[model samples]
Target: MLAAVALAFDMTSVLALMYPGRERVEILGQDGVTYVYACKPGPAGETPAAQAAKAQAAFEENATKFGEAFAAELMQGIEAGAPTLGMALDMTRKTDGWAGAITAHLEKTYGCALLG
Candidate 1:
């Protein structure tokens, strides 16, 4: 029984190593905007360190795009001035509702479970 358990564990680890899936990284910008980036796994022949470096490069490249969009939106909002209480409440409600919609979209699009 012990041998069987060990073998099962070994098989699982080997499979994970063989097909180590893409990585998801979430970055919170200095301006309080959050971005999620997905990096594809490296080709089979690449060393683990090289794979990590590639992923990091991809992340940095993608972060520029995300940051620009977020900054533009934030600047637009700031230029619009403060909102009324009702407007604030309405915006809050809409953002809250969007959480569920975004989660569903991600699951449907990517076929992956989301952790809150």
Candidate 2:
């Protein structure tokens, strides 16, 4: 589940850093890590973590878009040997691996994701 946790951070960072006017942006690489978060003090002068505080607000405002984007990612393989961790994470959180509020909130959230 550590992989899932790492991927989750990268996923949220990738989405939060998306340029508002971008027509298209590449979030994750073939290695399953998001390139956006890997860069240091990027062209925009803001680190990915610098924007994390507003992520929940952004998602709340664009819930539909967020959900769609998330579903799209779920259809693709994010890690080697793990076609997708959606089911695994879901099951794990329900079983002995539950991690408390964070997992619970994520499981209850409803939103759509936009690729662009």
Candidate 3:
């Protein structure tokens, strides 16, 4: 029975790798495990490390509900300072009831609204 189970698992792994059009979603975690959140768009050129950092920094800055692990990874992304990652982190920071802060910052810094 154990042998059969192992064989089944092996076959499933092989099939998963062989299948075409498999969507690979990257989950940024802490200690390389425990997902905090998932970002779908703007992942093409961004590394997992970068995304993790961004998420962490935003979490810290906004004191959002994101868990500790996620916040750490996001900090790494913020450190990298990649354009897409920065935008994503900023957007997330703007959320979590920080819209007022974001709007004021945008207006004060750029002379316009964050959305307008």
Candidate achieving higher lDDT, 1 or 2: 1
Better of 2 and 3 by TM-score: 3
Lowest summed lDDT across 10 adjacent residues in model 2 is found at 107-116
- 2 or 3, greater by lDDT: 3
Question: What's the CA error at residue 75 for candidate 2, in Å?
Answer: 1.0
**lDDT ranking from best candidate downward:** 1, 3, 2
In angstroms, how far off is 8's CA in candidate 1?
34
lDDT of 3: 0.43
Q: Considering only N, C-alpha and C atoms within 3 Å, which residue pairs clash in candidate 1?
A: none
Candidate 1 lDDT by residue in tens digits, 1-116: 35544443433334334334645444454446444434343445554334444434444455466558556655666678646565557556655665566545444434322221
Model 3 over residues 27-100: C-alpha lDDT tens digits?
34444543232222233556434444455445345434534545665677667775775667665764544657
Give candidate 1's error at residue 59 in angstroms.
0.5
Show model 3 residue runs off by greater than 4 Å: 1-35, 41-44, 64-116
Candidate 2 lDDT over 14-38, as tens digits, reads 6645534322223443345442322
lDDT of each: 0.46, 0.38, 0.43
lDDT-better candidate, 1 vs 3: 1
Instruction: Report the lDDT of model 1 for residue 45.
Output: 57
